[model samples]
Target: MNQSELRELLSTEGLRLLDSLPAWHSSDEIVRTIAELRKAGHSPGLVAAVLSQSKLRAKAASKFGPFAERMLFTEAGLEQATRLSVAAQHAGRFSKAGVKWVADLGCGIGADALAIAALDLNVTAVERDETTAAIAAFNLAPWHNAQVVHGDAESADLAGIDGIYLDPARRDARVRLTNPADWTPSLDFAFGLAERYPTGIKLGPGIDRDLIPDNAEAQWVSVGREVVELGLWFGTVARPGIRRAALVIGDHGTAELTAAADSEDEAAGELGQYLYEPDGSVIRARLIGDLARQLNARMLDTSIAYFSADAAVATPFATCFEIVADFALDKRSLKKELASRKIGTLEIKKRGVDIDPATFRTSLSLKGENSATLILTRVGGKRRALLAQRTTFAETSAATA
Candidate 1:
């Protein structure tokens, strides 16, 4: 974006520019470019945001520098684009259901819209902000039948839309949340939209379960093995039950749901001969019971997320690990054993331990050959540690990137 066009974009539209300067190809080049852009009228924040997004896009090899120059890559837009993995996740749902038409509401930069369109879905994308709407339009230009409309979804006429999708904007250019209440159209309002058609609501993983309407089936999704987003599905496939599903794309794995009967059942402790830790997505979905049933695993502790089952079973739901050694906590002994192993990397995964792993590793001088996962926790109310490696079955058969 040239200085003249950029100044007109910001000054005439009452738009808040976030970042818009090219990344400093070199330190001196960046200083020179910023000086020139400022002289031509560009805010530092705007310059920074634009350059940051450009850098990120460059990293991803998205050759859209000319487009970035015009758009404001605010923290919110970057976060909505990068942090929220719901678009790809919702696309996965379509891949599972074989659906082809999707209505992407509040499409922002059209990241999700593009993803779904890539999967061959006819996308009807709507955005409210002229600047953001324009960016979304540009991002989705490659997809045929991608209709980018400028309007608020809360009042937009909804007709002939097959599958509904909404991503409520929560933050502004300053990176401050505009209104907590505006995080989304009310659930009541969303339900109204879903009542007319199948819908998916993209939400933060931290959203409370109580906020989820009973009419919708909520599923937490992880992409590339990380639990990154949560979604609530409303319509024909929506279940009136709490469920958790793990999607390991390119593999055939059963989607598991928590039975009503099981939901009412209290969790119990079952520290047995083996231990299983459900993938983050499974845990987020609250499908522990289904996972246990799938693997014949039982809970190791009522309050902990660990699961245990004796029989050998291979499921994408979790990584099964055989406990080879369990010992009491003794810093001296641990340091001695770990040092003797010549361990160089100490990967500490702890539960119920008050010690900081970094300090602990440093204190123990854990920098040699003992590069393994060290699990520290309280079992039977006693502080202890477990040394383990990926089980052969898990190492070979587990779903991992």
Candidate 2:
């Protein structure tokens, strides 16, 4: 939001109204709410701003949890903000390293700062966007140990800070900036901070691996099976002999796999009784070999991340599927085979293949009461389809990254 609208939303009347409104829902009648709000003697701008914030608060709940109730946010700021649970891990590193004070540069909406302050550590959060900085200040007002500064992160004063965390702005005016150099406080500047203090840089999981510094500990973190961020830690916070790591958080709890480097893959073998799909974080961390070894599994294809085993294994790092049937990659024959089995409810999974699952589903024109999963991939360097059922160890789909 712009400065004027921000002022309106922060006003006593606006905040009270926002708090009084019912939680936003997709099915909620927007026109009626706007009319009712306008008729209540609130200005049009104030009503619009508060309504927008109410919706944003609902969306922010996924990341901020209960804290979202009292927090303020900008659309872009909330989008880039770290999930509180994940941010707590980032905060723990500094705490474990005995860093009492942290400089959270480019701290969008003060997410990481909130996590840090919750640990009883002092934090200085800096942001360049005027509106976002104000929103961050509102969110952080509850933490006496936290301070918000409206200034450039590259020039933010880090004098007494024991640790530094930088999340460079990767977007501009709602458009993503793909070039690393385009990032505000550029990688050159953020990475250079490691020379002066313990530093942590949060990057997208898809960032080029070659761009990562050899000295940093690259940790790929996944929440609920979704690979979220790649955090590179340097100096005291960086763990020795841990160059690559996968941190997975799920309903079952958290699981971690770390290695000094990418582990060598086990030799590809013939199709086994079960298939295991590694979580995105594991695949991104390049520790699939390590995970496979832990599960006593081998790769289905040397080039694919899919693993095959003689028996089902229960592990949080991967999802298990019991193979029921295998078929050649022929559309007509596959359709006939599925129809013969009365298969209707379908979960399509694919790797090392070109077909889109949705299109294939439509092409099949399926109609049956029974449910089954279809896995389209390569076996022995040739296309094949496997009909399988999710085993007890699997919680849900570990979506392909």
Give me the candidate number with maximum lDDT.
Answer: 2
C-alpha lDDT score of every prediction, in listed order? 0.64, 0.91
Clashes of 2: 0
lDDT of 1 by residue, 378-399 (tens): 6766777777665655453543
Per-residue lDDT of model 2, residues 160-259, tens digit only: 8889999988888888888989998798898899878999999999999999999999999999999999999999999989999999998988889999
What is the overall TM-score of model 1 with all chains considered together? 0.74
| Regions of candidate 2 where Cα sits further than 4 Å from its true position | 394-401
> Which ranges in model 1 have alpha carbons more than 4 Å from their true place?
1-54, 59-75, 82-101, 119-121, 172-180, 237-244, 248-274, 392-401
* TM-score, every prediction: 0.74, 0.96
